[model samples]
Target: MKVVYLPGPKSPLEIREIQDPQPGADQILIAIHYAGLNHRDLWMKLGQYGGKKEDLVLGSDGSGIVKEVGSAVDKKWIGKKVFVHAAQDWGPDKNAQGKQFTILGNPRQGTFAEYLAIEAQYVYEIPAYLDLKNAAAIPLAGVTAFRALFTRARLKPGQKVLIRGVGAGTALFALQFAIAENCAVYVTSGQDHKIDQAIALGAKGGVNYKNENWSTTLQEMAGQFDVIVDSAAGSEFGKLIELCNPGGTIVNFGGTAGAITNITAQRIYWKQLNILGTTMGNNEDFQNMLGFLERKKLEPIIDKVFPMSHAEDAFKRMEKSEQFGKILLEIKS
Candidate 1:
């Protein structure tokens, strides 16, 4: 098996030939066809995220065909095309992950390889309309977006929603799902072209946050949003608070822009705003996300696809924040 893994702390991801894994009694061995890249993988490469320092395959999303099934697993799964869930051991809590929770691409092997041996319960059949390449793009970002909007924020049809940062995979998925729900979706981006691209993808409109008075301009253009989904929560996070409608919900999945220093507690209480934090979704969220995509026949927005040999370039694209959607690596047949 060929794998792209981190060799040590602060190490560059490298491709190496490694032994293939066999499935356990309740596991399935998948021949991975595609793997999706996320910012978490880049953070792991830079020793920022807490992934294992040695022998770690660094990817969270993948789609493939089940080549073999373990003794305890039903044989029907063999030869089925499926996508692997990003989280493991989500435990019994639908509201939050339990103590045993662990995301893929860390201490355990992940999808950046030709083969993956994952727990049977974590595998889901790919939707009829999705090929392996696009199915690989959905697991991490799709579920995160689903949980953030529908689960955490409880977004409703016809509500006004704003997603901060329009180009990343998760944000793009949020925009798509919001459109599917018939919400009025707006977005912010540092690049004008990104904002324009977002509008083409069914956004009502968007603004470039690089403008000096972007927050004010956004307010004038879209008014206060009923829901705000953010990944970047730096000093500018206060602007998100200002953009929210009274009783609005704001969900944060990551703080890519660093720590927030300016959100006012008074405004939150005065407006009765709901500020929530969410990470990867639970099993139910994953199932619902896939079902929604299948029912809607939604295809993931793929920015670019790189071969496994060029996985480092894919990481570079993510580091530069240059992609408009999920960046994928073609692993193997």
Candidate 2:
């Protein structure tokens, strides 16, 4: 097997030949076709992500064919096209993840390789509407967006929604899901072109947050949002609170900018806003996400695909925030 291995923090990614892995009793071996990159992978490369970092294969999203199954698994799975659920041991809780939960590509071997051995339970057959390339982009970002929008925010059709920092994969998913549900969707981005791209994808309108009065401009353009899906939480977070309609909900999943600061307590209390936090979801969320995609016939927006050998360039693109959608590694045909 040839794996993209990270030697250490700030180290260059190397493609190395290593021994193939055998599946455990409840596992299956997959001949990986493609892998998707996330901000988590970039953090892992910098040794900033929590958990063991060195000598790791870093990827959370993947799609491939089931090449072999362990003795306890059904042989019928062979040759099945599947995508791996990125999180493991999400346990019985539908509301939250359990103690044993861990994402792929950290302490555990991941999908950035020619093959991967994952628990059979975590592998789901790809929908007939999707190809392996797009399927590889959905597991992590899709589930997070689904859980944040539907599970945490309880967004409904006809409601007005805002997807903050709209260019990332998860934000784009939220925008698509909101539109599919018949909601009026808006977006914000630092780049003007990204805002236009969102508008092309069914967003009602958007504003570049780089402007000093971006939130005010958005409020005038689209009124107040009933629900806001956000990933970047920092100095600008307080502005989001002001943009929400009374009794509106804000569901946040990441703090990429930095610590949230200087939020006015009176605004939250007076408006009766709900501020909820979420992470990579449980099994139910993953299944629901897949079902939603299948039903809506949604396809992920792929910004670029690089060969496994050019993994460094892929990471560089992500590091520079140059990608407008999911970045993928072509692991195989």
Candidate 3:
């Protein structure tokens, strides 16, 4: 099997031929057809993420056909199309991930390879409405967005939603999910064209955060938002606080921009706002996300798909933040 291996922190990713893995007694061997890229992969490449950084396959999302099953697994799963849940050992807590939790890739083998032997419980049948390529885009970002909006923020239909940094995968998923729930969705992006793209995808409106008065412009255009989902936590985070409706909720899952600064305590207390932080979710969140995707038939927007041999180009695109949606790797087809 050919795998994309990160030799060490800040080192370039390389393709290496490695032995294929056989399923353990509780595992299923999947011949991965497609894999999705995330900022997590980019961060690992840049030595920014914690964990075993050297000698690892880097990918969190994937979809494929089950080629074989472990002795303890049901034979019925063989030949079924499925996607792998990106997180493992999320434990029993519904509100937070336990200490045993770890995302796919890094310390464990991941889906970037031609084959993946994952536990049977962590794999789900791909919905009949979606193909393997798009299913490859769903696991990580979709679950994170679902947990952030529905589980953490407790988003409601007909409410107003503001998704920050709209072009990224997770943010786009949040936008799509919120809109599906009948919420009026708005967005922010560094690029104006991405804002237009969001509008085309059913967002009510959007603004470019690069503008000096972007938040003010959004407030004037869309009024206050009931739920604000942000990944780029930075100096402008305070502006998000000001844009929230009283008693509204703000959920954050990443800090790509930098440390949050200039936020005032009084604004939050006065508004009785809920400020929550979340990460990759528990099993329940993943299951709910799958159900939502099946119910809504929501398709992920794929910006580009690179062949396994061109994995470096995929990482470069993510490094420059040039993508409008999920970037994928065509592993088998």
Candidate 4:
């Protein structure tokens, strides 16, 4: 088995041959077909997420076929193609929920290689319509958008949504999702080109946020949004707040821009706004996300993919945020 491990903060991720992981009592072994790279992978590589200093595998989203089952898992699951929920260990403890380490990647060993073993409950059948390549891209970004919008923001059809960043893959999904539900979407993108790209995807209009008065433009368009999904968390957070309508919701999943923002008491109290934080989702959320992808025939946003041997190159591209969507690594025999 081949795997990637970040030896230390800002150090080069070393790919090495490691022993195949054995399935635990409630676990299953998956012959990984593909793994999706995300900004979180870059964060962990830079040791920005408070992950332990040792070696940490670098992925969360992956799809593959079942190779073996643990004692408690059903044998019927063996040989089935599936995508992992990726948040198997997102609970309070390492009980039936699996270990606390972010499974399939993160603090735990990941699926960057030949094989991975994880809790059976975290694995779900990939829709027959979707192949392994698309399934590999679903778990992290799809589930995050689903959970953040539906679960966190409780977004409803006909509402106005301002998707705060067109740069991240999640924003692409969020815009399309809101449009599907009849919500009017206003997209703010750093790049002017992405603004038109977003409109083509489903947004009613797009704003070039490079301008200092970008927030004002959004305010002038729809006045305010019932929901705002913000990928940027730096100084723009205050601007994101202004985009929110009274009694509206703003969901914060990742801070692509940067963290640390000034908060004003007036913004919080006057608007009666909801500030929600979310991460990788629950099994129910993952299932719903899968259904959404199936119903809409939505394709996973893949910017680029590299061979297993070029895994480091893949990481560097993601670290630089050079891609508009998920990056992938292909594993070949």
Better of 1 and 2 by lDDT: 2
lDDT (CA) per prediction: 0.92, 0.93, 0.94, 0.80
lDDT of 1 by residue, 102-164 (tens): 998888888999999999989999988889999999999999999999999998999999999
* TM-score, per-candidate, Cα-based: 0.98, 0.99, 0.99, 0.92
Candidate 3 lDDT score relative to the true structure: 0.94
Candidate 2 lDDT score at position 291: 88
- Local error of candidate 4 at residue 240 (angstroms): 2.0
In model 2, where do residues sit more than 4 Å from their true spots?
A: none
Candidate 2 on 1-333: residue-level lDDT in tens? 999999999999999998999999999999999999999999999878889968898899999999999999999999999999988998888888888889999888899999999999899999998999999999999999999999999999899999999888899889989999999999999889999999999999999999999999999999999999999999999999999999999999999999999999999999999999999888889999988998999999999999999999999998988889999999996
Model 4 off-target regions past 4 Å?
92-103
Give lDDT tens digits, candidate 4, residues 295-328.
Answer: 9777876778788788889988866657776788
Candidate 2 vs candidate 4, lDDT winner: 2
